[model samples]
Target: MIAQSAARHYANFKGLPKGRSELEESSLMARSTTLAFSGLLLAAAPASALARDYLVHDQKEYRAAAGAVKAGDVIRLAEGEWKDFPILLEGQGTAKQPITLTVQTKGKVILTGASSLRMAGSHLLVSGLVFRDGSAPGAEVISFRRDPRSYARHSRLTEVVIDRYNKADRRTEDRWVSIYGSDNRVDHSWFAGKGNLGVTLAVIRPKGQPEANRHRIDHNYFGPRPPLGSNGGETIRLGTSDESLSDSANLVEANVFDRCDGEVEIVSVKSGANVVRSNLILESQGAIVLRHGNGNRVERNVFLGKAKPHTGGVRVINEGQIVRDNYMEGLAGTDFTSALAVMNGVPGSAINRYHAVSGAEIANNSMFEVARVTLGAGADAERTAAPTGSRLTNNLITGQDGKPFRVEADMVGVTFTDNVTDGEVPGAIPSGLRKTGIATKRAANGLLYPTDPALAAQGAPRDLRPVMVAEVGPAWYPKATGIAAFGSGRAVPVKAGGLEAAVAAARPGDTLKLAAGHYTAEAPLRISVPLTVSGPRDADIAFSAPTLFQLEEGAALRLEGLSITGDKAPRQSGNAVIRTSALSTVANYALEIDGTAFSRLDSAPAFDLIATTPGTFADRIAITKAAVNGLSGAVLAAAAETEGKGRYAAEHIAIADSRFEKIGSLAQILRAGTDESTFGPELILRGNTVVQSGPVMLGLSGVQSILIEGNTFRSSGRIAVANSVGTPETRIIDNHFIQTPEPTVTKLYPQGSPRVLVSGNSIGGDAS
Candidate 1:
């Protein structure tokens, strides 16, 4: 009976004709006026008068009231901070009136700090709740099932917000919403700021359950998921690789993805027989990858990449995939992230591996100024099978490189007809895309519409204007930007007595001017926001705690014109006086120290001035007009790697007009191996004085570019180039090593003709 009611409700939602049972009152009214509980004396009052409504004040009251809640009952939780509340709304309701678990007033209740909800049983509804500023105790913030034997069907979750519910460690895998069961719908909601390692929302079909879930996810806002820097960071995922052959038949439509640069797959479709249409992707650096699915339809979607780096469209990987009528503009990715990629498949593959593309259709699409449209992409040794029996017809494309499309492998049974490009259509993946000189007309919204009449008639009507996430979510929820800016745009003054509190209250982009006095850092200060601490030259700090300052993700600190003295316990690595957190966000950080002095008391194994946590990196670090005297290890060590893959931390490090006397090596900026697809390992050192800093000053390895000019080294060791994995570009000119009997530069590798440019440097009191 409940399944019949679910079918009837879905039919009613689809505007289908009412059968002999249901009342045909109107479309606006979702429910019929039918009650079947022996009428209970047959009152002519509305269903609300007969239905029970409970106002719960606390968890004990809620637990007491939950058992007695019946069909058509409404449980309204009062507005407050519902922290650590484990909510379970388990009941049975008819299709017309679902058991509602909602807030007393909309947008007023906050569920935070280990709160989770599970809606088990049939015809349940949950709405108007906000999960904010806390992490869930479990893997999911809200699950649609309680246990293995019980789950929610005909359920609806609407008008909700999950904003920045992150664990302190972003590597901790947690999801905002996980859906199971069938005929469920999630709409008009907002999910944002998932910096962790899981998909934001997932339609999960666990093993031993092969039923088609048939979930509808529509009209929601997916906002600002920054790169997790690893896999498993998709915004919406349909199913798992283990359930790839099962037909979940999910529908994802009318959604907006804004700046979701989690991974190369933004919306990962791993289930079969799904419909993905009418969605808008804005500046996300990933594709809607049909990763392990088959017989899926991708149509009428809009990809406005805006020429951002690595933004893409659709990627086809399986059989019977139909991609058509999509309009894309300004995409800037290539190869695997092409605007439209028809990929090669693994031979004799498992269900988890890539299936070969067969009987695919690519038709009636219009692309404007995209980077590439690759066919048979990733055709290596294992994925040697080419896409066969596919039709590429009636598509219009204009590209930046003039050649929009390329064929990687042999086109065995593929056919191309009536396809037009502004550049030459390529014959091979690395080769030609022939220019047809086709004259095309642009639409009013600045996208190319199809010129062929049959292709034009085949296109569906869609709203082509760009959609902002702010338009669909609840009106009270603010649209979150990817990089959070907490600055109040005001300055604050700090004294020695109030330094810690001032640092704690300071926002990003703020400046704290310290008074000229002595201070003691007895407790470690963790600075996670970009702040500047400036003081006069007479100001000095004594460090007694484990590292006076610890840098976190996206944080940058500037120490200006201050003196520092530390007598901390001796440590070898990963324990610098200033260090990034090992569990920081996988994003860039920066540090700048200018006109500062460092003095170690009692020579207690002088700490490195600044070091990064292993596997974390800095975008930039600048040290100018600074004087330091240290005892041992590398002062700036950003050279940690993942199991010696030779990954370095900082992108650009520049030290100019600084004096290092009686200290250790100046900087060890090393990237071990050569992978040219990544960005910089660069350095700039000029006009510095190094005196009596023996053995090493600059330990360079796999550095792409460096400019070492106009410095004086007094009897210090040479700047050694250790690794020749990449063509290291080096320039050492016009420096003076005062009476130092060592060669100025040493190339460690035996690779011939290292690109070191050395000239006009005085070594051992003679100009060379």
Candidate 2:
């Protein structure tokens, strides 16, 4: 029934069917009746008996009227583009007469360009709004709770659409929808294309509060989220690790999570007493982890992996968590990050660390084609404490994989009973476990059930109850039999005269296939949307201009199977072939150059890649399977233009499986942040060959973790790696340095920074 309401809310607009149009003539009276019927229901009164109605044509009028809105008042936004408008709604209405904010003509009022809404006060309803083609810098697109004031109580946000709201660097913390306060509901909304940082929706528990937030997030569509490659990217997070002990009493039911593989722990339940039931989690990379808190219930959910690697199932931790009646099919994860992982807790763990799983009940669940199920995972080293007083009973597991279960040595005080598995169960399994074969088939009600009457009667049914593929995403998504709606878009082919023209004419998800020939760019190409430009191995791009590419805000550039070379321009000074500026309005940007080459750049200090926007930053930059040779300057130079208090920060820079030869000064090979700001905690230089003539191969400051492994460095330099500020962990291991100078790796501020271990490297004949 709740799902039906969500469907109705999404299909609320009259004469506005998606992707098509039909002109329908109606009298003024009929139009008025339709408009009034869409208004807020006041005290169970009929639509004609509403107190007052105000038509706001623009943001200016909307703002003015929003300040003075009263109970039983309905404000209708006129049809047009409301760009970068920040709406702060504050009103108090009785349950009988709630305040409403809606559109006059649905699907016609488009909100773009950093537009957002912050709802305050109680008994408020915001519905039938569309937010797309924009991003909110350092904030959520729609927030029901603001800092220092949680005013949204008994509020509802329905029929809302937040699509493609992203940041510039993809590292800044933000969300699409943040629900706070008690008795609030977010239903039937659609959230798609949140490729950057932050969750799609988060239910935050206010600090120092004992009462649970009691929010209901149901029937919403959580769409595709690309892997963020770090922590803090989840589809739905109930609470943070800090508030793990707080009872949220949140109910997340009947929602569809489609390909939401943003990071590990997809639907993270960090709080206690929450219920995650009857939902469909499809092909996501992470499982629904009970990371913290206690007494949580995870039941009746469907997890479909379809044989993808890292696709997960329930991962249990903490205490008093129940996992039952769930169906997992074609899951591939094993070991600690396995299909059914009952993690080994750390002894005397704090609130933030992994706590022991006590009083857990894994009962009556069905697993098909799972790689491995385990208990006491990660108990060997990190998580040394075993779970206590846990029961695994009456679960039916059948697969061809021989290794069905792996119980670690340290696991003790576990009771496994009546669990039937047809595969080769481990020898250490408890005594009462049985090996049985169960027959199953699809029943008339569209659910898989055990055909054998005895198996069905024993409550140990073995059935891979697959979710209807057509019923998987947003309610209004076009139904295709046996197709997942979240993974349904196809890239259109684009052909143009030049790269810049192709990028300008192409849509967000279009692919431009370049022919195998040399292409020249007179001016730098500006990219403001996510695009993929690929070609054959023989294709190349030559840059005559000072800068070859200029990435704007919200742009993601991927270049593969191509070579990029710089022309010999003598007059060019202190410029790069590819550069980024801080003047962009968008927050996050991505640049991926793979299987490419950069050579013959004769300019003085020829910086091949320069990302130095003073106040702006990029999320990820990856250069792999490429070669950099015959360059006078550093191959990669990234730093904030301005020094001191205004430096840009980039995250996740990976240069792997590549070759660097005949480079200018080894000191200039890789220059990460300036003396002021830090680049990232993760800078990976692995499986590469670097041959330089100068003193240094890498220089960094204010970094966190640097991995320099499995590389051959042939240099006469003084230092292989140099750091100014003290980093936490720098591993210079497993590298062969030939004909190197005095110091292999040096840390300038050795006292402040931790020591960089220069071991496992055959430097100048002996391991250094």
Candidate 3:
């Protein structure tokens, strides 16, 4: 972004004062010059003094070739997996002719497994390379500076794909791209599955850096970035708390943010003079938040929420901000996550805290829902200052006629002028926004445009269109998705052979249809991809492995209609029918076992039917229409390492329409008592028939919510459920007990939490 045109664009933007034009000038210049600049940076040398191609096949050769790099020189890497190579390159080139570092062929070179790319030079272009299936050697996947003191200027990274290249632990923080230096660009790359900690892309101003670090990020495809379950999950972040008052002049344009629900702030702008425009947000349950910056513009972006929960448009805070010409619809967020939320600021706030909004403009935008527009958002103690000297002007809002706007602040020093809405909004002046009947039709580009001549011009600029998958990211990426599944659901027939080998060969999302024969498994069946192994109930596996099956943390597996024996399970306790790998300490899990049966050939009597390791936990464990006869372990179990302090392991445990006969104690299924975390450590045991089970033991310490309904317990039964120290909800209804022959009584509630509903059940010969 350090191009001359980019610098001039900032100076040329209309209505922006001297310091405010830095971002606008750079953004419009990047959109117009990036394509032509790509051609210039990538074209072969001009048959002049600087033109040469250095083809490197190894780390040693690349180092030697980089030393001699010059203007218009092409340093090409051989096509294959280059593992653990740190390609730190630096060179100088002219604007007309740049230094090129690329692969022999597009999308063919794989730089994976601790490999990295760092550049510190002028007019450099890095393209057509992939980094995947491994983590970076350090914190950043790619760095614009070779070191802290040196940085790359006026460089470009395009057609590069970083897919599933991550560490096993989700807490390991590392950004995919970290921009430094001045006027650098990253475009047309495919970045996905950034499940680990850190922002997907970050623009940083290292110490002693220039005032305006103009960076351009455009036309990239940001794929499914699953929630990080904590802070530091923004898909793209600009600047930081320390640099809040400085001008970044960063430009983010025409990219597709797909399902990146990592945190409440999708694009956290923490610095000043940045422009975010023409971007499309699809089903991501967060917003572009002007969290700490001033003199920032959020414009021409299309937010298509489709009523998905938590989806938002833009949230404005700080000062001298403009939120304009954006089209938002079907957003279902409120307060801080509202489609357009102007927040209350903390008085005399610190650098990291929210500051008061002054001289802010929210103008010429269109919204289809009332929940989308929220004024005076996030009002609480210590944040008593409301927005002052701000205007919401000439915007169009269409929603329910009577639903009142969320007005938390008193709206001091605020003006609502020439704003139009179809409803009689309670917060806004009724006379200012005249009511109208607005109808819209889909344009050729599949976007709705207003039929009313006046309203049509009030929303986002018509020139901005919804970004398609093809327009962003590398052309050769295998998958393009917002929330696409892990696999394509294709079936690969499993012939008579080693089932382990077959599982390794199968692609992700593929279903392996097992043949009705003896499949030998001498090792743990390691499933590192999403797969479904299906067969009839007659199919069996003679697994002599440490564990029957081991799964990569994010990988999902479905076992259907098969039989397995677990007597060979190791006494050292690697025994698990399906266990997540310990390589990753923590992550969410998806496991399904349907119509499958387990038989132990020996009398071990102690086994783990399904288990989780110490630090790892599952979000949802669903076992439906299955039979675990002669079971020796809990259906699901994990250690409550931090028990009684609030955090229990799993989110949801569901075992439905199944049968458990001759099974051992299920006390370890859920034992964390009085967990404070909401939405789970919940268990749903419905429509199951238990015979000769281990007394139906749910110990004194239990889940937050337990529903044991429509179950038939015969000969030995009682339900003891509660949160000893915390309040819990337990519903035991519509169950039939043939004989109440169990030893323990069916009550475990403590003094604090006594909300257990045990109704509509028959304890004797009657049915309730």
Cα displacement (Å) at residue 487, model 2? 18
Q: Each candidate: RMSD to true structure?
A: 8.0, 9.4, 7.1
Q: Could you tell me the lDDT of residue 248 within candidate 1?
A: 86
Give a tens-digit lDDT track for model 2, residues 1-768: 222232233223212121101111111222332234343333223423655677899888998889888876778889988898888888986554567888877677888998889988887778768887878744788888655565688777866778767775555678898887877877667777775667789987767765787777766777777555445668999987788887888877667787776666788898999888767877777788898889898877787788765577888999899998787777776654467988887788888878988999999887777787877765634467788898988787766375678776455567888777767767677464677776778665344556767567333233323334343333444321221211123454433346767767766645677887777777778776667778776677876677777777656677777777776433566656667764633345667878878777655565555544543455677888988777766666664433333133455678889888877543232333323112243578889887764555566554555787897778645445555442235787888878765344555443233447777877675322
Please list the C-alpha lDDT of all candidates, in the order they appear: 0.73, 0.67, 0.73
Candidate scoring better on TM-score of 1 and 2: 1
Candidate 1 regions off by >4 Å?
1-45, 403-407, 429-470, 482-488, 492-502, 513-525, 533-548, 553-577, 582-610, 614-768
> Each candidate's TM vs. the true structure?
0.74, 0.70, 0.73
Error of 1 at 414 (Å): 3.1
What is the descending TM-score order? 1, 3, 2
**Residues 662-767, model 1: lDDT tens digits:** 7777887766653322234668999998887657677777776688899998867767765443235678889887755433455544432236778898877632
| Candidate achieving higher lDDT, 1 or 3 | 1
| Candidate that scores best on TM-score | 1
lDDT of 2: 0.67
